[model samples]
Target: MASLPEGALMQRAAAGLAYAVIGHLRGRGLGGVYGKRVVLLVGSGDNGGDALYAGAILARRGVQVEAWLLADRAHSGGVAALRAAGGGVVKLSEGYRSLSGSQPSVVVDGIVGIGGKPGLRPDAEEALAMLAGVPVVSVDTPSGVCVDTGEIDGAHVTADLTVTFGSHKPCHLLDPAASACGTVQLVDIGLRLPKPVIESLEAADVADLVPRPAPDGHKYTRGVVGLRVGSATYPGAALLAVSGANTGLAGMVRYVGTASEWVKRHNPEVVGDGQAQAWVVGSGSADGANSALAFARASGVPLVIDADSLRALNGPLGVPAILTPHAGELAALIREDRGDVEARPLHYARLAAKRFDAVVLLKGRRTTIASPDPDTPVRVNTTGTSWLATAGSGDVLGGLIGSLLAAGLAPIDAASAGAWLHGTAATLASAGGPVTASGVAAAIPAVIRSLPAVSS
Candidate 1:
């Protein structure tokens, strides 16, 4: 509406969608749209209007367009346009059995729009079930997906293509629902929308955010990330966490644990305990995790909380911090069921961030980074393969994020950028094979080097 007259924008949406549908049908070896079977699931609102008009355009070219009105009424003008162009309309009750026999070339889902809630009505569900195998193109958003939250409560349309206007919605960037939107295409209808609240960082963005050393810089001057992790019982945790901190994101790494000598043996550059710009605690701190976290918190600098340390700080973090936890750990932290958190990551992650007033980095194949502010958009990282879910992978991530924090980035930037790098490293290290946590940590420097350099 900002760019064109009220009705004109809708027309542009219809035209662009029509082209996409035609292209899809042609790709499927349907020859062309002419005389092909096209079915539309139409609601009563503007969503129905877009589908009705697009169907009308295809109908004029000899496509057999049949629109099933799911609502009590149809878009009057749109219905008239379709009838004028030789398209047929029927109620949903009359659609199911007929569509099952037609072998539709494509199905257009226009039963719901962005503002509608999650899950489909029973009639809509039955209609979708009747034409289960047919290709579906959604208007604006897939029917029944929560456009803002990406949280699905019940049945929803899994679209083969989603043609949106203005810009992509939260569902396009978020997961669960994102998985349902097969391929998304943005159609420019000359409408200028507001700035996107959520975003995912790419390689170039990471390169820009990474701290560069000055010519006059010394090791400490650049930044030192100190680790107060590990125990006699689990010394390997300190080694893995130190491995992550040694990615060269920070100038220097420090260790303050029972495995100080052991950590230095693995990476000699890592020195004994000392003051650091930032601290990473709890990875393997075991029984002493609570004491170590208290010590780090007393330093009054930012810290990365992971593993045992996370268990230590069960209450509000009370300091500038990054909270890294996998699904099970995050579930424990919030006292929610593990299966529930796994099912709804964004919901639980945001809850943790707001509850603790810190940056929460929920670890998974599709990692979610949420800031403490309620209005800030959450970032989703889809960089690594499923194989990256191996054990000790998160300890490496905690240290890497700690290094970024010591380098003076805000908690959110530090957490998100570190996650991006960590995931990218896993992908590079894997090379189509299984990769261990140490191998992923070892690959970090190469990933950093491969990134696009910032122009002076």
Candidate 2:
């Protein structure tokens, strides 16, 4: 399957792109591409060819098409086809000021495709600078972005909508590049690429991954999540994490720390101490690393390591662990290994996964989940809002993942499901308003119930 031919793939991708651009324009009250002006920024590869062919179709529809050749050499066949269809290449010196006055409704950025290096060439950058104010639709991955790693090196284009081919690439899902790709629409090119290098979790995917309790299942049968968190100094973190875990998603919760009494007071169903199918270590346990490590080592099940527990990852964790780190903590982890997290998140996440021999969940605006195996496609969680970044949100996320692990999902599944559910719950709780950590926890059951039921 990996050996599928490329020529056939490019043709299908180009055709799909044409249809998508036409449909998008039509949807915006521009019926038929009749009087619209489209500028295609052509490069030196099949990507430029895709744009040239797409320009040919638009020209045939009576649309005024102009191809701005950025490369010294352009796609020969594509350029010929565009000229045959009445389109002409304009000199780059026409300056963006002149083009902005034309007010072209849509600009097609075909400057570079997936084969591009980290940043744009000086010439490419100069051309892009001219089109700054115009609305752009990027073909394939956004230009100047690390397609495989999802990093934006030097300068990159911010697209109004990115039309991706086949499956989604890492750049479409991982931040800060994901933020640049405004709205992503996948074009089915019928090319069976190898299993995706990275994947984003959708609502339906989360529904399928979240385990449902059996009708005859008891609390113990549902699987227990042991949480070792909270201290005299920061007791609220433990409370918030436990509050999230008690959303009727887990069979039972067991608290193991000095703040066990505090957790027991809020939710009496929690056991003082017992065996657990999963463990949630690190939260408000600022100085409680020893307790977190002890609990994690003893639990023999999947673990969700977050906040302070992340600092305790020096020793052998033994169980299937998921490390949740924000940019700061992640940067620290990267610093320990002489790497940079912000420069390349995907690379760092993958490295951490292998080094720890566990699943790694890097949290940010876009939460990324990666396993130790490089071939395993990273899962990005997209269903979140800016309000979800409020304080204590990470603790809630840890509890949710711990619940999934207790429900028997594997470490990766648990992390992905938890992130998805956490985002969904935040959306529901927000309802166009601000939401607190407690509100997010209260919204989990509704989010879970809203999921599409699985069919036999």
Best model number under TM-score:
2
Kindly report which residue pairs in candidate 1 clash with one another.
Answer: 35-62, 282-309
Task: After superposing candidate 1 on the true structure, give the runs of residues whose Cα lies further than 4 Å from its correct spot.
Answer: 1-3, 22-36, 57-63, 84-86, 431-433, 453-456
Q: For each candidate, what is the lDDT?
A: 0.88, 0.82
Q: How would you encode candidate 1's per-residue C-alpha lDDT over 265-382 as one tens digit per residue?
A: 8898888778899999999788999999999999989989998878865567678999998899999888899988876888999999988888999887578899988778789886
In model 2, which range of ten residues has the least summed lDDT?
334-343
Counted clashes in each candidate structure = 2, 0
Best by lDDT: 1
The residue-by-residue lDDT of candidate 2 on 1-456, one tens digit each, is: 457765667667667777777877887787777878888888888888899888887888888888888878998878888899998776566535457557676788899999898788887788877767877888997898988888887888888888998888889888878888878899887655777778877777877787887989888888898888777888888888898888878789888888878788888988877788888888988888666767577757778888887876763377788999986787776564423576677778887888888898988788878898777788888887899878888988888888888988988898988888899899999998899988898899999899988765
**For model 2, what is the alpha-carbon lDDT of residue 420?**
89
